[model samples]
Target: MYAATRIKNRQRVCRTLVAALLMSAGAGAASAQDQPTISMAINQSPWLDSFVAMVDQYEEETGNRVELDVTPFGGLLEKIRNSVRASQGSYDIVNVNSLWLSEIYSGGFLAPLGEIEANYQLPEGVLSYGNTTNWDASAATFSSDGALMGVPVNGNVQVLYYNTEIYEQFGLKPPKTWDDLFANAKAIQEGGEYYGFVPRAARDSIVYNFTPYLFSHDAAFFRITGPDQAEVTLNSPEGLKALETYVKIATEAGPPGPGNIAQGELIQLMATGKGAQAIAVIAAWGQLEDPNASRVVGKINAALLPAGPDGMIASSAGHWVAGIPKNVAPEKQKAALAFLDWFAQKERQVDYVRAGGVPVRGDITGADLGDEAAFRFIEAYSQNARHAVMGLPFASAAEASDAMALSFNRAVIGELTQVQALNQAAADLAGVLERAGFTVSKLPDL
Candidate 1:
């Protein structure tokens, strides 16, 4: 009879503990529902899918509802611009590409992140990984009125991706310079096994893909001389060399109809083993490793872009920053800032990498990721980022990129020589700067 009584007493204690836990969870849920719902606008890329999954966790913990507007990248900027101009509080938080930061900030579309930084006690340089400093002078592109405008969330740079199996079969090594790249590409294409190299040539994307080549040769469309002054340099000797190399790669060894290839198509060509090599954004690394999508999964290696005549390796920087729109309601802004705080925490950033998004925090990037191969690629990407230069940062950067793209396209299609294409491009870029109220300097003869 004493043993039975002890058993009953134990059962009674377990039931009481369960009831208390349930009560606590219910209370937490009640508190979560008290806050207003937040709406966010983000790209519809795979990276954003991972981010949305994380947002789901945040919502469950805080009891705040979040509505996501996942839009295609092409139309996202115009959508945000219109909403901000109309002061429509449709989105409490928005994602801003580094390229568009100047236009967005200059238009008073984003709230200054200064108060949020102080409230959270965020450390200096917390948002930057690799060689990018949080408040460097270059960061002025994303700031306005002497205040930070956004928190960086993604870091990207261009890298060369090559098929290791193909290289080994051909008894070859990766190229170290543009000349080496051309020679290897020619030899591989002549072998008739695979196309030598592939890259995006679409007019809208050609400039981005061509930047590493241009920078390697120390060429630029415009050189910033001061805060508001820039000089046209697209017709320089370096510019001609870079353009000639770019055209030769596509004309001599690239796949048929190279003028139509875009970033996505270039990645697909490499992933499926059709192309032996490619130069693309670091984000493509994940796609190359996806077993379901890639035939060459685990058979590819990434490296820094090849050097130019100057023996310098340069890449274009492209990252995304998150900000609260000025049109957001006051209370909603607090909620959005709270979410940013949670998202930027180092531990959370590490988790984000595991979920397929790149981490922009140095601590997280340098952490011990359990996957060895992934860590190696991240290391390479971070190293390449160290040598990256930002694309044009002015409000008219889009127009300037368009000018360069058109010139590159014409040259790639044999419509004009490299010198002719670059000269015309320089003239167009000068027009863009002149309209933006900056004096354009005369170009020397090539």
Candidate 2:
């Protein structure tokens, strides 16, 4: 019900903005060449700190100022939406999740990045997969009519973190398949010193844990046939099976009170050596590997998520994508591209890696991947990265994500059966699509 209200409100905002754009087209045309004083949005992370430092260096070298503003992820999105509605162009560049791509662009609020991309050579290994001519096959977060509209600034994937000593003590190797993971984890728990697996089973992180498995089995939240297209596709047998598998793992191998395990707390359990294995995002593990910050130091090993019946397991790509605001001046947009190209440089990216950015470049893997566990992570990321799911552009992504959480939360507490939980979720998702006037026929088949 909350989701339905949010959808209605968003549509009204979009409608008002469209009418305003039509009335101000001429004024907008004239302001296109003005010097673009840019405002940018970022989620808090170590990489963001590095980004600010680099921006300072660039300003010093070029004598042109680029203002850097930081906001929580939620606050940033709200501000961007409100600013665009007012035709204020408060932000010149924004780092956002993939689902925001279509809505922002369709609202005539974001500028296409093709002109910027073509004007400068992008850094090597920085979203090279997304730069190809055939965009559907590329890893780009947003593409339309053969043009890439965003640049990937981070490498995001789910991976397994295990204790090396636990594996060796049990004479076990890193799990290459889901069954292997289950067996190894179960046996290791016999010592009673640690549990076999720890996962983020909480409401906030349930989708992150479940969606990849669904996609690996060739299922998805929506089917898309085009940019302005999408339809519900979660009711299929494959999707149900995937959800069943997710419930099985959590029920069998995950810690007690699993639904209470928030993402941060779950990772912290793994880092402190209370658990032998964890399924989580790469960034969290990377922080644990840092000696200065981590309490476990030199104990945990990160590896690939094991395969499912279909093939190797897949993960979602949660990247920070950069796009220009349509309101920004053209020359400034050009400069922003130049800055992005340089910022994405492999050498500069090394700085990002040192600051704990996931290695996005292929050549940097293997020997260049440094220490043993880090290599394990990079290897898994390289193999599974291509299969990672791109988030959908629902009118209310936050709402949909929340609904998914509620269903899983109920299942976690044994309040609902797997079938009941997913059934409720599917109905909620369908209602959201209908309310937004979005048809599932436009999305890609899972």
Q: Compose the digit string of candidate 1's lDDT tens values, residues 49-109.
A: 5576556555656666677776789999987887777756678778877677667766667
What are the runs in model 1 whose C-alpha is more than 4 Å off? Answer: 1-37, 61-65, 119-146, 362-367, 374-376
TM-score of 2: 0.81
Q: What would the per-residue lDDT of candidate 2 be over residues 176-288, giving only the tens digit for each residue? A: 87778878878877668777888678888887677777777778877655554566777667877777777766767757888888878787788777778888777776677
User: lDDT for every model?
Assistant: 0.72, 0.62
TM-score of 1: 0.83
Candidate 2, residue 10: lDDT:
36
Clashes of each: 0, 10
